[model samples]
Target: MNFIPQFTQRSAGTEAVVSLPHGGRRPGRELLVRALIGLAILLVITLLVWFDRDAYSDSGGDGLTFVDALYYATVTASTTGYGDITPVTPGARLINALVITPMRIAFLVLLVGTTLEVLSNEVRRVLIDRRWRKRMRNHVVIVGYGVKGRSAVNTLHQQGHDLNRMVVIDNRPASVDEANLTGVAAIHGDATRREVLRRAEISKAREVIVTLDRDDSAILVTLTVRQLNPSAHIVVGGREGENVSLLRQSGADAVVTSSDAVGRLLGLSAVSPNIGAAIEDILSSGVGLEVAERQVTANEVGNSPADIRGERVVAVVRNKTMRRFYDQSVDTLQTGDNVVVIRKSEARAEKERSERD
Candidate 1:
């Protein structure tokens, strides 16, 4: 969709023509067909006039035959009234008033309709294109459309979600178009601006991921987003390790050093290949399960891992080693021990219902 605005101005005596760019294929073809048909009809009328010149002349100075009537209709419809061939008789005058006048009116209506249709199509195309750009949900919004930002977008796109809502905000048109083409909503404006955030609908957004090249710009974006919507989880990718803490202090929930994440992944791959594969699968594949950390605080049954009724505990990530926690284990629960539970949708719903009751 073209982001350029269509502007039109009308003066005191001059008519304004708003030339709409060719929108879609169908409407453009329809307009062309209509104009061609109208031209064909006018040509046919002219041919009939040329064939019966004697019949037209029989009425003398008063009567206008087929040729004269045709000529008058053409000139009037074209808005080029030469006044050379005047209708003389009352019959001819009445014919001119009815046929010629109505023909001119019809031509004007067709012209206006075609023009408006094209313009409407252009506007609709832009809206639809914009909608496509913003179709992702629960997505990470990157502030800058730079290399790191682009890589993040590609990774997110590869790691498909139920709702792929990703948006990129940069003050450059080319960057915006690049983002848009990648099926990400790219708004051309300052990410630090409050209005730009408003356009991005930052409040309801799940996560705001800032990967601006400069530390100052990323900091500003993080601050603005935090101020606008405090609850939104903000993640920033920065170069300097020192600035990471500063960005976090400025309200970034998590600061990701691109180098650090890469290094960590590389180190983990060397130490534990299987663990690295699992991590990569979780990050890259939608089907990969996520072992969420849920603290079992309430001992409705008893202060024991085995006594925690309802849901199944898959594993216990204690001392960085995953220990399989069985259902029949009589072991008591520790206060700070992390429980890795396999999330079952039915179990979750039951828990919710029981809590509500």
Candidate 2:
């Protein structure tokens, strides 16, 4: 049985705030349905009284008519009780007190409750956002919720990173909502906007990932983030290879060119399926095979790459510089060196086993 390595990080307890767009309001289906049902009930009760015209008296000296019934129903259901229409018989009065009153209350609730709930929820959301902002620090800011951005987030989660310490900012409301549904903080706004970036606490962010669909937008967002936090790690995804250098120049510490990467993957798959599969496995976290960086073990110290047992050492990172296994300088592992290894991910093994059973 393989064991998955897990890391524990402290929670910052900061939540994401959402900025809703202002537009024309449309009634929700629930509200519309309830309103129709309430109206139907009121009409039914009014019609019942109107059919038994002798049961009602009118101060206006008009014998009960369909118009009178409709007017009475409207006034009664609204609790206005214009006093122009009165139930004269005991049957009518009993029905009014027992049936009409409750229905009237229901009608009012159906008509007005949705608005009150919306307002209450808005106030509560604002309060929660204020609290969230106060506690946010050293979080990861994702500038877009596009495909690349989402994949990056998924990998971070599988690597045991604290998602609560991450915030997603996107101009698309749908994307923001999707992030929120996954329990990550999301802000619906253009990431290139300084105010939006500031609201996301870029100054205190430890890292920022820019994955805007447009290379220009990603570059602008990266520049804004870099200006906000000179020390933060800024990684950007550019759609075109030519923009990769532009993105890096715009202050991105790393730039992944989408088209070039896809092309490379395709080429590798066509040339050697096994090698391509191995690369894919390593790129995908918590999968069949994975690449991970770990501190040099006590047993590994003073040992060559070929001497390490159980895992394959692809490279060694010493003093923030990476050297491949083929490099003679990295032949002997030293203390403080990080080993980049390729091995079967225990999480994937367990998941496969579970699926099999």
Candidate 3:
């Protein structure tokens, strides 16, 4: 099985936290249903008294009407009796003692349901926050769930990374809602702020990605994340080529200039159709060809990159160092070398099994 980290995010002061929708009615709906049931109880009592009008007396020394019965039922069910109406016969007294009293208790319980639900929401929030924080060690936090952020996560997920270990941080409510809809936790806050990063547990994160719209904001967030997690692998998205060095200096491990990358693709498409098509195929994930990294197995040791049967190996990583496939230093694949290869997405399972082989 592939073991990948999970995801989580928290906003300032634990205010904007929501997980995937679980089974339950909405609080408003629940309250409405309970109110209807309480009303039903009150109506039943009112009808019983109204049908036997001679059994009840009014303070005005007049025959009891349906309105008087309703008033009596309302006051009695609410436990706010005004002593203006009283049961005059054994039948009315008996029904009040046996039926109305128990339903009065039910009515009160339904009213209390509203208060209980409010308290339950607060308690549930606390428990969920605690559980999430407890399981958040060494996870990935992707700040700013824009196009870049979505692409990065899509690549990771297609390559068998765990979506549960992915947390999205965005200042937009819509972005946060989208993350939750996709089953990824989200934090709604400014990524450049210290408290926001702390809320995401940045210090414990293994990887952080900054994909903010503004290059300046991305740089600031990268610096803040780096200061918080000196050992984390932070990848940033840059809008302009000029800010590449500034982003790197801000502590981004790698920076992708989106505009330049797109511009090059556009140029390639105009100049050479075949080259552009091949590049697009490699970039697209979860279908057709995909780029992935896997561990070298016992079956493939001491073999050159060209010897791999299923996938084409492009680079080899050994001892924390990467060597190009053409580099003679990595001609023989070592037992623990990690190879970056291009393989069929549909055959991903076969490729993963190759690691064990």
Best-matching candidate per lDDT: 3
The alpha-carbon lDDT assigned to residue 64 of candidate 2 equals 86
Q: Residues 1-357, candidate 1, lDDT per residue (tens digit)? A: 343322222233432222121223444467789898677656654554444443443334665556576775587677787766654456555655676466667777787888897789667656654554355445567788888788777765553532136667777656765665555555666787787676666776788889887888889889999988888888899877778888998999889877777778889999999878866655442344433556657553246555555555766655545567764442556655677664434334566789999
The runs of at least 3 residues in candidate 3 whose Cα sits more than 4 Å from the true structure, single-residue gaps closed, are 1-21, 26-74, 86-103, 347-357
TM-score of each model, in listed order: 0.48, 0.82, 0.78
| Candidate 3 least-lDDT 10 residues | 1-10
Task: List RMSD in Å for every model shown.
Answer: 11.1, 7.1, 5.1
**Candidate 2: lDDT over CA atoms?**
0.79
Better of 1 and 3 by TM-score: 3
Clashes of 3: 5
lDDT tens digits by residue: candidate 2, 79-114: 888898899899988988898888888888877887
Quote the lDDT for 268 in model 2: 99
In candidate 2, residue 7 scores what lDDT? Answer: 14
Candidate 3 clashes between residue pairs 3 or more apart in a chain or in different chains: 6-164, 6-165, 7-164, 7-165, 7-166
Compute the lDDT of residue 254 as modeled in candidate 2.
Answer: 90
Put the candidates in TM-score order, highest first.
2, 3, 1
